[model samples]
Target: MHETDVAIIGAGPVGLFAVFECGMLKMRCTVIDALDAIGGQCTALYPEKPIYDIPAHPAIAGGDLIAALDRQIAPFAPRLLLGQRVERMTDLGDGWIVIATSAGETVRAKAVIIAAGAGAFGPNRPPLPGIEAFEATSGVRYFVNKREDFRGKSVVIAGGGDSAVDWALSLKDIAAKVMFVHRRPKFRAAPETVAQLEAAAERGEVEMVVPYQLHGLAGDDGVLRAVEVATLKGEIRTLPADHLLAFFGLSMELGPIAEWGLGLTHNHVTVTPATCETNIPGVFAIGDIATYPGKLKLILQGFSEAAMAAHAIHPRVFPGEALHFEYSTSKGVKTA
Candidate 1:
């Protein structure tokens, strides 16, 4: 069994940052993730997707952000067990917790941090006949891994949410012809982004197919030719396309955390706002998996929660030691 001061049950951005925070406080951590690699959904889902809200860098891809976080926590030398889903947590009752994983590895820790973000983000696949066939050939894609792949191709973007609208705008200049098809006339994207998309449409840069839903996929022998969309009144229109990009929102699953018996609020772990601790002592939840009063579901907020959880857990890891709170600037990080 691996032993550490803290066992972090997610290796996403927030969890990686938590390693840095805990390391700063002299806490050793063993990080575990269900994914084969770190960075969570950011690394897996949309590595090429540009994130605009992250501080310092005005714009960074999801993959780049994870790379930077990984580097930031490198000095901590935290133990990482990838591709292993934590199955259960056992309270040793003597200030130590035992964590069991599906991989048969066991971890004993002074405290636990659940940093799994909003469970897992699985795309909601559109129910189109022969969709599975096209999907196998990359003719229909639910997630954008590489933007360049869609270049010079007639693309049909379907959905009303941010992912659909955002990708349409992002690929408008790259794709040979961009078609935006949504069931509703009004989009569910941010106002500013919607305005930009509309402005692009006005300039004839994008073809907007409104009040329509994905009807079927037109393809043969693993090759796609067009996307069929229809209105609520059964008006069918076929948009000639090389590839169909469906951006229906993702479905979230808490996975094993739901079975861990933590106080859950709509699949999110209920935690104390002050310390980011769950109903059980010595087990803290942070990032998107955690919920509290007035909590803003943002990466920056999750970073702050990581710090709070680390500080609250410091005492348990090192009993009788008073934590001298000091800013990073005052006492720069020292590699262990």
Candidate 2:
């Protein structure tokens, strides 16, 4: 059993920032995450993708942004528990007890913060017959966490969303042959990204297959060799490929937190307007898992909410003493 002033459930950007914020307030923190590393989706989903709205830099890769954030919070020296999932939370009459399963190890803590952004939405695979068998043999990959693994391999990507297009563009120079297959002609990616992909296809850098869906997968020696696709005109065609990558966006699962009796709307924890406190006392929800009036799910907004939640907790933890204050450009006097 370990004790801490706060325990964050997810080690994403929001939760990592919360750890630093709490440390500045002279409070101890413990961060728990399901993945082997921190940075959550940024590191796991698309590390090579560039982000433009991070405030300080005009553009930064997802991996680099996470690294910078990790460096900023390193001085805090917060406890990090990776590959852990909170099974249940109980009120211990004094504070709270968080019971978690971390790589087969049982752990406990106080004051849990749910910062799980789009919680554990596993990869979406195409509805194709024999795909399961192919996947079991390592012929199909649903997530593109590692881009270099497909070097010199024939790869076929499915989906027109950001993830699919981004991976396609990133693998163009690495993979032996890269092909993008989308059910829609127009992409849901950014205009610039879509244009770049189109230009790549025009220059023979990549192949584009539109308005088609996968029907089946065929392989040799338990490894994918060809893909069967169904055209919009009800025609079937076979394409040779070494690997199949599906980036059909993710579907979120609320997990046991949804049954914790916390007030929720549309499967998201409901919180107060200014402070990120939930309906339950001493419990707060931040980042994408939290929802309030006019709440927009963004990294910057989550950082602000985490700060507010920490301030609100300081007074409750120490009822008599005057809480310390910090000057903020947006909000004048904030207690920590």
TM-scores of the candidates are 0.96, 0.85
- Model 2 spans > 4 angstroms off: 58-61, 92-110, 320-324, 327-336
Question: In candidate 2, what residue range of length 10 has the lowest lDDT sum?
Answer: 327-336
Can you write out model 2's per-residue Cα lDDT over 153-178, one digit (the tens) per residue? Answer: 99999888877887888899999999
User: Which pairs of residues collide in model 2?
Assistant: none
Candidate 1: C-alpha lDDT: 0.91
lDDT of 1 by residue, 126-222 (tens): 9988888898999999888899999899999988877788888889989999999988879887788899999999999999998899998887797
Clashes of each: 0, 0
Native-to-model Cα distance after best TM-score fit, residue 193 in candidate 2, in Å: 2.2
Kindly provide the TM-score of model 1 when superposed on the true structure, using C-alpha atoms.
Answer: 0.96
TM-score winner among the candidates? Answer: 1
Cα lDDT computed for each candidate against the true fold: 0.91, 0.80
